[model samples]
Target: MSLQPPVYYIKSEYIETDTGNKVSRRATIAGPQNIILGGKTIISSGAIIRGDLRRTGPGHAVVISLGRYCLIGENCVVRPPYKTYRGTFNYYPMKVGDHVHIGAGSIVEAATIGSHRELIGDIYQSKFTIIKDCAKIADNTVLMPNSVVPALAHFAGAPGQFVEDLPESTQEMVEAETKSFYNRFQPLES
Candidate 1:
């Protein structure tokens, strides 16, 4: 059976960059200079990216770095994780690798989210969480602080835990899905 690509009829809500990054005008992006979007990433309406939360005592810091073909769904908040060290609190950088999809209404304060990871709707990823490559976080899941999700694992529940191992084809599947999603995201014809 052939699968159909999802279609979104977004009007003139998004601003497409030269590098193919589509960022919604309604999205609240703090400190655009401190955020690096690799390419072909989509930041939907109401998404908030807190790039102003930078590390202390740094000349120049990248608070949030997102790789190619990433999707930050509507109303999602992406913030860097912070911690205290030697009586000084500092925000750490958050890195999201290629083909990552963070669903709508999700709040992420993760240190690292590896390539080909999919986080379903309404999920909360706590500070210092590490989600490895090809991992999937189910809808409404909450990943506790400092949680580590192994590669190819499917995690779910309030305090997310490994539910099962994903198929070996997960990487390819995610890559194709993300690419297709990006391609199918279109501006509605007036």
Candidate 2:
């Protein structure tokens, strides 16, 4: 008899999306708002997403948009930037691209992350990080605002910057890894 892959035992705290995304119940999405989820993204437990805040628009503007294959780690906060408008404070829209992974306890004020470094653990990521496609980050790296990371690379250190480019062979590997990570979390059958 053929064997099935062993089912991973995730805590009941996770809510799996129909499009293959896993959102931890403990994670704060702050519904009643416009937080877009691209596809196959994972928001780990304790993650806080401030979808309630955004700039004024046609009454249906989107804020904090996350792309496919993205991961938001535990206790991380994803919020849009805010500035004074007409003597009033307002937040702007933030967009995270595909195949991105942000580690735990990070504060995202920018619109993008991951040269594909997938910010894995606690990190200081600012609003100005420019990560190209297929980038990877080493643990404990702090990504400051206005920094740039090229594609197919690795990032590390405080105020984290793109430190090294991954070997070309790893490109396909990262793609596969992204798919695998998305598939790894499944809803427990009731």
Q: Compared with the true structure, what per-residue lDDT tens digits does model 1 show for residues 66-91? A: 99999999999999998999998889
Poorest lDDT segment (10 consecutive residues) of candidate 1 = 3-12
Clashing residue pairs in all predictions, respectively, total: 0, 11
What lDDT does each candidate get? 0.93, 0.72
Candidate 2 residue-wise lDDT, 1-190, digit = tens: 5533633536577776688778888788885257888878888888899888756665745477888888787799988766676897666777777767787787777756543446667666666556667777677777776677777778888867657767886656666666666676555654
The TM-score of candidate 2 is 0.79
- Candidate 2 minimal-lDDT segment of 10 residues: 1-10
